[model samples]
Structures are given as structure tokens and as C-alpha cells.
Target: MTATRAPQGQEETRAGLWARLGDRLIVGGATVGDHGRDGEIVGLHHGDGTPPYDVRWSDTGRVTLVFPGPDARVQHFAPHAGPSAVRQS
Candidate 1:
């Protein structure tokens, strides 16, 4: 994984990322009152805690820039390869 710095003028445009880098994002059922997609955060476009993530989607194996919505949830991948916490928004 590479360290990412915030983009020019992007810090003022939005808040922050829904999940941290290397975190797993589950959509659809995890989406605020919705259900549907799942992915792993492979890159960050801003600060470590910032938004507009580069997600490598699980189903498609494609990387996409994502601004996670209310239905998003994060599963912190542990050193042991297990989920440490499952936090929902």
C-alpha cells in the first residue's frame, strides 16, 4: 500500500472517508437502509482518514474510486486475518 496525501482543494470539498485504508467496505446490506456491494480499500486519495477511496471491488475485481454513503460499513482486517471490528454508519 502506498501513502496518500490529500489532493489540491479536495480537503475543502468533502469531509472524510467512510473507511480507512486497507479496511473492507461492505455495501448494500451495509449501506444505510440498503444492500448491494462489497470491496476492499486499496488506496486513498487523501489523508489517511480522508474520503474518495480507491476500492478494489470484491465481485468485479475492479478498482473504483468511491465516496461511501450512509449504507456503508467497515470491517477492520486484523493481523491474524480476522475482522477486528464491524462498524456501521
Candidate 2:
């Protein structure tokens, strides 16, 4: 899965970036040996897939609100991305 990320050492995120339900989030670890963590975007607090997303972690199955940092990347696969895809908050 391809991801649009800032330059190798750059910290800023690409413009117009957002996520939705069913999207996969991969967060990089501090070191290369660490595989880091991944999760599914199960809830959208603003219904717009903005920050502070409710994520269900694949490793722990724990759901938590996430504010993605520079180390985090999202892989979206929302075919029907629009009003119908948004859930009532």
C-alpha cells in the first residue's frame, strides 16, 4: 500500500489529507527494529475524518482517540466517500 508522506526527514503533512472509517493507520516506531503500530479508523469524531480519530488497534483491539503525528500515516480505502459515509456524531 502506497502512502503520501512528507520527505524522509520532513515533518509536515501533505495538504488535503484526511481519513475515514475502515481506513488503516500505520504509526512508525522510534527505531527501525520496531514494527510500530497499526489500527483501523473505526470512528470519526467530527464525521470528517479529521484528527482525534477513534481507532481500533489491530494488536490490542483497544479503541482510542488518535491525533496523528508526523510518524503516522494513513491508508484509506473508502469507495463511497461522501455524506453517506459519515456517521452522526
Candidate 3:
């Protein structure tokens, strides 16, 4: 998986990025070693899978945007699959 970022690491996100609905967002990329946040893509602000995705956090059930950041990456799982298996992108 590649990291998307604004030019010079600015806090801007470009539109048209593809994100599947229900995909998981893994924060910290294992650098935090299992303590990072885990969230699911619940909705999209844009229909075309753009940034600022609506994410429902697993640990807290808090819904928030999966904003552009260096510490986050997306993990996609097969449809109807159980939580035991996770397909990372």
C-alpha cells in the first residue's frame, strides 16, 4: 500500500482516491505495535471514494473521518468475511 499525502506533507487531500466501502483503516501502520487505532469505512463524503472518509472506530465505536496522515493505511477485507481474517492492502 502506498501513502497518499499533500505536497510537502501539507494537510490537504486530493479528490478521486478510491476507497471501498467497509474497508478497514489501520492507523500507525504497525509502528505502534498493536496499540494503534482500527476503524472501518462507514461512509464517504464524496461518492467517488475521496479523502476524509467516515470511519467507525472499533475500539470506541466513535465515528470520524479517516483523514490524510502519514500514520494511517487502509486494509481491505473480503466481503462477508468474518473478523478472523483480514486482507491487507
Number of the top TM-score candidate? 2
Record all residue pairs in model 3 with backbone atoms less than 3 Å apart, i.e. clashing: none
The residue-level lDDT of candidate 3 at 20 comes to 58
Q: TM-score, each model?
A: 0.56, 0.67, 0.58
Candidate 2 yields a Cα-based lDDT of 0.77
The lDDT of model 3 is: 0.69
Off by over 4 Å in 3: 1-17, 29-34, 79-89
Give the Å shift of residue 83 in candidate 3: 5.5
Better of 1 and 2 by TM-score: 2
**Can you write out model 1's per-residue Cα lDDT over 1-89, one digit (the tens) per residue?**
99787775343223434455667888666446665888878887776446677888888999998887876766655433433354457
Number of clashing pairs per prediction, in order: 10, 0, 0
Compare the candidates by lDDT and give the number of the best one: 2
Model 1 CA deviation exceeding 4 Å by range: 1-18, 29-35, 79-89
lDDT of each: 0.67, 0.77, 0.69
User: Candidate 1 — worst ten consecutive residues by lDDT sum?
Assistant: 9-18
Report the poorest 10 consecutive residues by lDDT, candidate 2.
Answer: 77-86
Q: Candidate 1, 6: how far from true, in Å?
A: 25
- Model 3, residue 63: displacement in angstroms? 0.8
